[model samples]
Target: MDFQNSLAFAKELDANDPLARYRDEFLYPQVNGKDVIYFTGNSLGLQPKRTKKYVDDVMKDWHELAVEGHFYAEKPWWDYHERLATDLAKVVGAKEKEISVMNTLTVNLHLLMVSFYRPEGKRIKILCEEKAFPSDQYMLQSQARFHGLDPNEVLVEVKKRKGEHFWRTEDILDKINEVGEELALVLMGGVNYYNGQVLDMKTITKAGKEVGAFVGWDLAHGVGNIALELHDWDVDFAAWCSYKYMNSGPGNASGIYVHEHYLGKKDIPRFEGWWGTKKETRFLMQPEFDPIETADAWQLSNPPILSIAPYLASLELFDEVGMEALIDKQKRIVAYLEFILGEIDKQVESTFEIITPKDRGCQLSVFLHGEGRSLFDYLMKNGVITDWREPNVIRLAPAPFYCSYTDMYNFGQILKEGILNK
Candidate 1:
């Protein structure tokens, strides 16, 4: 498809877009009395307009039913989280029984490690990418310290080659082989947060398993952004936050996926909780812990319905337009954004070096050569909401559900002016 930098071309594309109408479903913040071109959806998604009703229903249930809301409310606060399982499973490409909502991202990762990170004498090292998300880095370091090992000795990093922006699949596989018998776990972010590179999880997971290591993914950015089949990929366990592309809210609840192989097993080595036990026997006050026959066994407490409400609201949009359709629009829209960036770069004296590789999802992290924080400030003041990393990189994520092609074109215009004025 030939790309153009004009507004008419952008409008033509938007006119034909099947997902265009869904943009009205979200509420955006205004700058100078106009809606800002939101590019931070990868960090925190815009709240769905329907979210208020979901939250209100839960609040109303609590007000009317009080203690009876647990089992007698309209949606039943006891099983409210179960409403998210089926649709959430469809978004991440897992069986309904293999997915559960709980806690937060880092918290769930810590709990999952209890079951998957059993390091024997010879197999104690963990493999992760260099400069992972700060939360993940801290989590891995603390986990190793908890097990009485030097983090520097127990955590092996797969570093990118000098001057390169992304990791090669071969390098990661080679690192897994180098760590060999010492590799107890292979856990890394599925989509790199810094450069927006989507790592080849299937190949890496296969390599980790071949070396007798338990493989898992921190799908914080990968969950709703890219195609994932944790069950088919034979992933042992995985977890993600709902605030990003999933569009729940700020620091909302998280989702987890555990393989069916570990379900219904008494010796799976997980922390026990009343909510994780079988529902029928939960109120019976039994002495023994009978784990649920699904991924819910990993849950440690009853889900917070207020947090899950917005998530379930977002999943309704996912159900209306499936991931397949979302991915289709994502590819075309991101391609158009790239074209706009190239066109703008040609017009301006400054260089825009896009570090994000072709394997990216919605985000395009660009190194703004000859630009500074003032340019980012100018963009924000002019109603372009983007994320600025340290140095001069800006991440522009035009999420498919709400972002439009005209936003990309208009951003190109605003960006060119910002560079020229500087």
Candidate 2:
């Protein structure tokens, strides 16, 4: 689709957009009595208007039904998380049984690692991309230390070439082969958080399996933003937070996917809790853990109904439009955004560069050359919400669910003004 860097063209696109009505579903922050152009959904998603009603339903159950609400509520608290499985599975492209909405992302990562990251004998090293999200880096370092191995020796981070901003797929595949027998686990983000580069998870997974290593993905930025086929990709496991692109509230319960082959394996080591036990016999208080034969087995505790409620509300939206429609809009809007920025670059004497890859999600990380946070502050003051990474990058994520093409045009105008006025 040819894109024009004009408000008329943007409004025309918005008028034709199939997903345009979704913008009203969310509540946007206001600045000077107008809605801010929110492009920071990559960091924290805007709250859906329905989220309050959903959480209120849970609160009503608690107020009237009290303890009996566990079984008697309209949507029973006891199995609240179960209601999300089918819809969540569609968003991430996994079987309903393989997906479970439970703990937060990193917590689920550690739980999955307990079962999948089985480092022994000569295969002790765990491979990940360099500059992974800080939490993941810390988790990998500590997990290696927990296994009585030096993180420096056992944690292998694949680095980009000196001039490259993102990791090349071949480099990752070659590293998997280079490590070969010594690599126990291959864990990386489905999308690089910094540059918004969506990795080729299928190829990476195949490479890891070919080399006898367990492979998993941290889909924190990929789940609702990009089209994923985790089960078909043969990814051993995967985890993602709902708050970012999924537009669930902040720090909401995360979803997980465990391949069916591992579901019934009782011999697999896991930090089991009572919630992991089969629901039928949960009341019997059995001493031995009878794990549910699905991703449900990984759940450590009964989920917080309030937290799950917001996610359920968000998932309903996902189920309505589906990933295919959302992805189409994603491609179009991102292309328009790129086109607008390119036009801005031509008009302004600014030196910023877009570091994000073309094969990416909603986010485009702009490297502000010979400038600093002051320009970012300028965008913020003018109600263009974006995120700033360390050094010189400002990330903008125009989410398809709520962000319109006009928002992209407005962002370009504001960014151009911000650059020119400087």
Candidate 3:
């Protein structure tokens, strides 16, 4: 489809969008009596209109049923987390039994590390991408320290070269082979947070496996933003937060995936909890932990029904829209944004450069050369909800579910005006 940087053309695209009705499903913050062009779905998604009702239903269950809500509520609290597994499996491209909704992203990463990041003897190093999310960096450092190893020596990073903004697949694979003998784990973000570069997870995972290293992914940005095949790619394990593209509210529950090969392996080390025990005999209170036979074995506590409710509501929309339709719209919206930005570049002597790679998701990170934070502030004052990174990058995302093509055109206009005025 050809893209045009005009309001009429943008509206035409919106008119033909099959998922246009979904914009009405969410509530956006108002700016001067109009909805702001929100482009920060890469950070926090807009709230779904049905989220309140979902929360209220859980509140009502607690008020009326109290403790009995565990087993007798409309959707029993005892197994509430289980409700999301099948839908999440479809989103992540895995077997239903291979996925589970559990604790927050980092906590689940730590739990999975206990089972997968087994550094021993000569193979104690961990490989990862450079400039990872701070939380992931801290987790990796602490995990290495837990095994009495120096983080400087144990951690290896795949960095961008001289003037490059992204890592090459061949360089990454070559690094995996170079560190083959000593590498114990290969943990990376499926999509880079700052630049929105979608890494080739399948090839990377295969390279790590060939070197006999455990491979995992932090899919915080990858989960709902991109199409994935964790099972088909033979990923050892993966974890992600629900608040970003999943639109489950801030600090919501997370989802995890473990390959079927590790399903019933009792020998795998994990921090066992009663909730992870086999449900049939869970009430018996057996002294020894008898783990479940699937990915649910990693669960440490009972489901947080209220916190998980919004995710269920959002998941219904995902299931209704489906990945095929969602991605089709995603590509179109991204292409339109690129086209509009390119026109802005040609019209003005702009200092900004789009550093995001071609293989990307909804986000496009703009590097403001020698510019200060004032340009970003101007956009904020003018009602463009984008994310500002330190130094000088503004990350914007036009989420397919809620953002219209007109939003992209307006953002490009505002951005052009801001740059020129500054």
Candidate 4:
């Protein structure tokens, strides 16, 4: 498809877009009384218009049912989180029994590590991408320290080839083979937050398992943005926040997936609490811990109903337009965005270096050569909401759900003006 850098062309594309109507479902931030072209969905998604009603229903139930809300509310607060399981599973490509919505991303990662990251005497090292998200780095470091091992000795990172911005699959597989018997775990972000490169999870997971390592993904950027089959990939465990592409509110609840192999197993070592027990036997208040026959076994406390409400609201959208349709629009829209960037780059004196590789989702991390922070400032002031990384890189994620072709064309025009003005 030939993309043009004109409003008419953009509108033509938008007119034909099957997902165009869904854009109005979200509420965007305004700049100068106009909706900003939101390009930061990788960081925080726009609030779905239906979200208010979801939260309001929860509040009303809490007001009316009081102490009995757990059992008497329309959705029933006791089983509210359960409502998210089926649709959430569909979004992430996992069985309902393999998915559980619970704590925040890092918290769930820590809890899952207790069950998956068992380091024996010879197999203690963990492999991750070099310079992972700081939170993940901190989590891995602390986990090693908690287990009485030097983090430097226990955490091995697969570095990108010198002068390359993205990691190569061969390099990761080679490192896994090199770590060999010492590799106890292989855990990394499924989609790199910096370069927006989608890792080959299936190949990597296979290699990790062949080396006797437990493989897991921190799918903070991968979930809802890219295609994932955690169950079919044989991933031992995984966790992701709901705020990014999932469109749950800020710092909302998280979801996790554990392979069916571990479900209903009493021998697996996991930190247990009342919520992890079987619901039927939960009120029985028996002393013994009876784990749920699903991924819910990892849950600790009762879920936060308010937080899960927005999540359920967002999942409704995902259900209405499945991931397959979303991905179709994602590919075309991102391609159009890239075309607009290239067209603008040709017209402007400044150079635009896109660091995000072809194996990416929606995000395009471009390095603005011969430009500075002021360019980013100019964009924000002009209503092009984007994410600025260190130096001169700006991360633009044209989320397929709400971002339109016109937003791409308009952003190109705004970008050229910013560069020419400089």
Separate clash counts for every candidate: 0, 0, 0, 0
RMSD value for candidate 2: 0.8
Estimate every model's Cα lDDT from 0 to 1: 0.95, 0.92, 0.92, 0.95
lDDT of 3 by residue, 98-169 (tens): 998988999999999999999999999999999889999999999999999999999999999989999899
> What are the TM-scores, per candidate, against the unseen true structure?
0.99, 0.99, 0.98, 0.99
TM-score of 1: 0.99
Residue by residue across 2-49, what tens digits does model 1's lDDT show?
Answer: 998999999999999999999999999999999999999899999999
Q: Encode model 2's per-residue lDDT on 343-373: one tens digit a residue.
A: 8888877676899988799989988887788
Candidate 4's TM-score reads 0.99
Runs of candidate 1 with Cα error greater than 4 angstroms are none
lDDT of 4 by residue, 1-422 (tens): 87788999999999999999999999999998999999999999999999999999999988888979999988998888989999988888899999999999999999999999998898999999999999999999999999999999999999999899999999999999999999999999999999999999999999999999999999999889998988898999999999999999999999999999999999999999999999999999999999999999999999999988999999999999999999999999999999999999889888989999999999999999999999999999999999999888999999999999999999999999988887
Candidates in order: C-alpha RMSD to true structure: 0.6, 0.8, 0.9, 0.6
lDDT of 2 at 137: 97
Candidate 2 residue spans exceeding 4 A from truth: none
Total backbone clashes of model 3? Answer: 0
